[model samples]
Target: MELPVVKYNRSHYIETDTGNKVSRKSVIYGSQNITLSGKTIIQAGCVIRGDLRRAGGGQTLVIAIGRYCLLGENSVIRPPHKTYKGVFSYYPMKIGDYVAIGENSIVEAANIGNHVQIGKNCIIGRFAIIKDGCRIEDHTVIAPNTVIPSFSVYSGSPGRLVGELPECAPEMYEARSKEFYSKFMAT
Candidate 1:
């Protein structure tokens, strides 16, 4: 099914040369450390924390989001942190193409693969690795250090493998995300 045209106020967003639409109402820290690929949409009230890194001052990539991705309203995207040798360090979050995260989600994953769809009010725990073609249902809480395999549907509070997706899931997800981006427009 195709998505309906979603319109946003022209004055509320900043459209990039690469076709990314970022909301002015959203708070994105350390913008230089964050990379948003083309055609990505970051909705209002979202918070992307790129400033939460190690003390070393060289430019470390905190978050790298791929093409045709959407981060919904009030969502939080932060890099995962780990304490090693009595020092805390934040690792980069890498999100692949055609990913869509629903409203009110907080994702601190180490990596999210292509065609992944995460639902509303979800909490993807720190250092979790979600593989390609995965669907995480609404209000789900994936545990830390969890590794979600490809082509699976996970749900519930401590998200478990509830079901398996068909082999055609990748193609379907790609089409769906692309269509959503196409219909998302400025009013």
Candidate 2:
């Protein structure tokens, strides 16, 4: 079965293929360069701006979202701009396969591992490392430049390591990953 095709307006030097299922309401600039594949869904109201320059007319920002990932409603992922010196040069927010980012989560970070679930309204700061199989609960704030190793459950403001996930959270995250693959990916 062939998938449905959708297209939107984009500026020069930007490329979006029919493999991606993007919403009409999602506004992607023409200057930004993004490559998406394998059942990628750009949900409604999601803004992926590849142009990092706040002043405009600069080199386009490069955003690479891996396969089988779900960027929830209204989630913004982009490189940090010079306007905020505190988060300058924070680029290449590399999210691995099978990652689920909840709504309103602002991620201007370095790397997010595979099978990670970041809850709603969470703040993952610049250069923060979220390892594989980690569950960052809702409203959690991961401070800048911190490292969360693999197989941990993170919650609370200024997020800290509460404890191990009783060996169930990882399973749950994997299950969710499978569901995403079935429902969104492999369509």
Candidate 3:
């Protein structure tokens, strides 16, 4: 069976054959350093900064997003930056499959694992590691260098582990992600 084509605002975006819907309003710099593994949706007003290379500066990849990932409108995905040896430098950002980032969020995380859900207006700090099947609540601020364990629910301003995910959470996320991908369309 053939897959359905995902339609979008053609004047403002382009939907690739691999199911990548990238809006023209979004700023994706250094496309060479950014890899989208297909079925990724980058919404309007989003900014993905792949221009920042590694600290050593040797043609390293900056942002690598896996399949069925969604970056919501007005959100910013940038590599984590730090001052090392009295010089400011940036590090790479890695995101796994079936991840969804909510609107207006700023993500500077080093790694985001599979089936992770980050809510609206959230702030994921520098070098933070989000493990698989984690759900981050809206307006939460994850501390820099923090590590989130798998199958956990995190919330609050400073971001605390409020609870653990249900046993069926992973399967649920997979279904939901696929459903969302299939339903995303302009008309």
Q: Who wins the TM-score comparison?
A: 1
**Two-way lDDT contest, 1 vs 3, winner:** 1
Per residue, candidate 1 scores C-alpha lDDT tens digits across 1-187 of 6689998899999999999999999999999999998999999999999998878868988899999999999999999999999988899999999999999999999999999999999999999999999999999999999999999999999899999999999999999988998888888
Model 3 local distance difference test score: 0.92
lDDT of each: 0.95, 0.69, 0.92
RMSD of 2: 6.6
Each model's RMSD to truth, in Å? 0.7, 6.6, 3.4
Per-residue C-alpha lDDT of model 2 across residues 104-125, encoded as one tens digit per residue: 8888767888778889999988
Prediction-by-prediction clash tally:
0, 1, 0
- Which pairs of residues collide in model 2? 11-30
Off by over 4 Å in 1: none
Query: Can you give the lDDT of residue 134 in candidate 3?
Result: 93
Model 3 C-alpha lDDT per residue in residues 87-182, reported as the tens digit of each score? 888888999999999999999999999999999999999999999999999999999999999999999989999999987887788778888888
| Candidates, ranked, lDDT | 1, 3, 2
